[model samples]
Target: MRTGEGLLGRLAEGGRRPLVVDSSLAALYAAGSLVLGQETPAAPWQPMDALGRVLILLVSAALTVRRVAPVPVLAAVIALWLGYIGCGYWPVVNSPAVLLALYTVAAAHRTRTAAVCAAAVGVTWVVAGLLGGRYTPLPAVAVQAVAFPGVVAFLGRGAGVSAERSRRLAVLTDRLRAEQELRAERAVTEERVRIARELHDVVAHHMSVVSLQAGMASYVVEVDPVTAKGALEAIATTSREALEELRRLLALLRVGPEGEPEGAGEAAPYAPAPGLDRLEELVRRVRAAGVPTELRREGTPFRLPPGMDLCAYRVVQEALTNVLRHAGPAAAVVLVRYAARTLTVRITDDGNRSAPADSPSTGGHGLIGMHERAKIYRGTVSAGPRAGGGFEVELRLPAPHAAGGEPVGRPHP
Candidate 1:
């Protein structure tokens, strides 16, 4: 049985040689039938002569072509069988040709075609049995003639269903992969834009201070050497500080997996971010930029959360930067007041001598970034032109605790 299965497997692979070999095997089986019932001495069947044997061989050869042209081969086999019946051949056992034709029709044809062929074979079988008078009214013989073809048709339908399911799964898998790739690309693009905005804000703010202090130092180098020397020293310190902060921001991009190479001095720069502890220095720098600023603190001193401290510092830094850029060298006031579980910082500037005809729009993205920072710590920011003159910015941040804790100051190295 295993050897026979191997031969059928080779035949099903469908080359011309395998097909021809399968046809020879089917013909041999049919020809052997001529003598199968004759060997039973108790009930001997009539034997075929040379002509009958030749017709049987022709029918078998026709059936060898069944897989390639099932309908035509089935017709030729049925025709040969009819002729054999007309020639007085009784109870012919060479019915393997018809069985092989039925299997081929079921495997190759659609439902309607297979049904028509099955009905025709049934009719021919009944007619032959009636005419030969060797027919039995038994169910077993009828089942043998029809059951093999039905099984073949069922298997063919199953194969079609399996193929369709596989195709659908492949399509779904491809679509999901494409969607995932698109989302990853979008995320990378957004991160790049955010980093660009941060770099612009940091560079513009620090560079403006550096340029102003350097100019002051150059102008007083001969007239007031002592003060000029002090100014130059301040310039150097400010430049170095700016460089350190820039390096810290850049470090965010250097992260890598465990197996990736590490850069020299793997420890991060800029120990902890600046906050309210440096408010006096911030005021001095603004003053050096030719902008007079007043700082006022009210209520009892209290500690603030780390996130709130950072947010407050950024708010003051951006506000003063905007004042120097847009508000000109005007006098500005900085007020910090803590009251009723909230800390409020307000920076207001009077009109500068060279103020532009139109102030920069509050709806601009710089203000939007400040608002986003405030919102992160459950804070609110309001900025607009004052009623009388100048522009004012008010930022209020919620303080969860009022009792003394760690001082609201810069992080220690």
Candidate 2:
């Protein structure tokens, strides 16, 4: 994002390999001396021979492999340059090549190998100063010998440390970025699943009731006018309730600040959330759809925590809806049990025996959602065909030390 960061990223992406660049630079420097005929002044040392020219080429070439094989490059370049010095030639072109290899060794390899190159450089420098006929005493030449290579080694080691730190930091930054992206994706998935559950409860339940009542009204309009009129009333009530629930769900999904929906149609007022108190309404709807479902409660009822209440209500709603849709002329019974530490729900219906269409074995999303809801309260759910030609769904939720409430109201006939 910043200028320095952008430049570094582009450089890493666009640059040639390190080996290529090193070889090119070393060759350019060598060509200036070897090709142009400007030789370094080594007075007492003899002129360059054919063997010495060959050694110069070898030293230049070895520089290319410094990064890839630092230890081997150091050996080859130093050996060639030492031979060039032994063959009565002055320390000039090949000397710098040896230094380059020493730097590479310190920069790329371990401390032990770099130490070896530094010691060798010091000894070679002292030997050259003493034997080349330069005017210098032993101690003065020794001091000069150790100082230059020791300085070069220290600088190279510092550079190596910096480069290593940069590499580790880059890897850490990339890992953090990947983790952040995963967290975002997980949050989006959770929101999507919650919306799906709301849609099933809001639309599926009411639509089924409307369909059943409308069909009943059409069937008996002439033969039984009184019954037909009541069916029509039920259909009208179901449709209006469905629209209201949809509007409430849409309001819950509004982004950020709350206000009237910005659309051609005005938003509906918010309604209180449904819970066990509205259990009779759910039963009446199921019965209107021609599926006889009875709700039975054992022990005194208790007010559930808001999250637990919503989860339990949705589980019951989904189970009953599945019975009406897939159970084919079966009667369902819902049993709710309250204890000191747990609340249990059991729904059983005498339906077709092979398998219900929305069973877990069929990989239905509805069954999967019921499982998800139960797991939220550290609960468990089991849904499958029963031994006796039907299907059953059982859910248990933890409710430690939950105080009791008044008895639940009775279900409608």
Candidate 3:
């Protein structure tokens, strides 16, 4: 059976094929009829003429196209079978051929077509029995004639429907698998783009600070030793902070199987991300870098969800960095407000000068990164040239009830 299945599989590989499986059964029937005619004196015997021989050959050969052209081949074979009977030929020899054709028709067409074919073939069988001068009782003729043909048709239709359903299920499974693969690929691509954008923001802002400080140290070293030393110290401080941020970014990229970010041949440090608590330190460092910066709180302060805290910190850091790099000699104000529903951070630089060519509002990644970060918490940030001859960046984040609280207080949780 396995070998036969393999052969049919190979046959279907090229295209559709009828593969005359019933022709052998037709030949066996003919041989059995011939043997019975010679040995059994009581057996029904009807000799065939030229027309009957032609009809038998045609009906048996028509089985070859039965699978490919089921309805038409069924019609042709049944017509030939009927003609053969009318010509006074042995009817039993053609029984297998008729059965094969009826099965093929029922398997390929709808139930209506199957019912029509069943009725036509059933009527033909009755007419043939009556014409053959046999003493078949009317009730026996009705039961056997209709029941046999109808049963063959029903079994064939069932098998055909099951095969078709299997085919459709295989196709649907393949399509779903393909769609899943495409979604995975798209997710990977989006993650890569986000990583690239983050690296851009980190390098651009920190390197700008480092560059300005190095230039000041170089120019003042010959005449003002203390001032140049202070500039060198600022550069060292900025570089250290930049390196720490880079480590965090690298850890995010190379997360290990155990949910740990790995870097520097070791597990990432357990240092908490900078948040509102680091605002004073951030401002101190910016002031040391020669950008006058201030931090002010207008309402009761609270801790935030980890992701929201990181977003808030990054937005402030980016905005201050922009002031140092793009706003010439600007004194920036950082304001934090804890409102009923939101935590707002507003940074405004007092420099009336136009922003630099690489400003975030002019097709730069810093603003894009800030926007992306805010989106994570369903928050928003707006930045533009202020009407009062300066630049301002304001961000508002949702202060959910559970996440808004002082570290020591229950705060209505």
What TM-score fits each model?
Answer: 0.55, 0.79, 0.81
Collision pairs in model 2: none
Between 1 and 2, whose lDDT is larger? 2
lDDT of 1 by residue, 383-410 (tens): 8878877888899987657444533443
Q: Rate the local accuracy (lDDT) of all candidates.
A: 0.70, 0.75, 0.76
Model 3 agreement with the true structure over 134-244: per-residue lDDT tens digits? 756777777878898889989988988987899899999999999999999999998987778666666666777788888889999999999999989888887888788
Candidate 1 contains a number of clashing pairs equal to: 0
Worst 10 residues of 1 by lDDT: 37-46
User: lDDT score, residue 38, model 1?
Assistant: 42
Tens-place lDDT digits, model 2, residues 9-71 = 644654568757987977885675475323645566666556666777777777765776667
Winner of 1 and 3 under lDDT: 3
**Evaluation by TM-score, superior candidate among 2 and 3:** 3
Rank ordering of all candidates by TM-score, starting from the highest: 3, 2, 1
Pairs with backbone N, CA or C atoms under 3 Å apart (clashes), candidate 3? none
* Candidate 3 residue 356 C-alpha distance from true site, Å: 7.6
Residue 161: error of model 1 in Å? 5.6
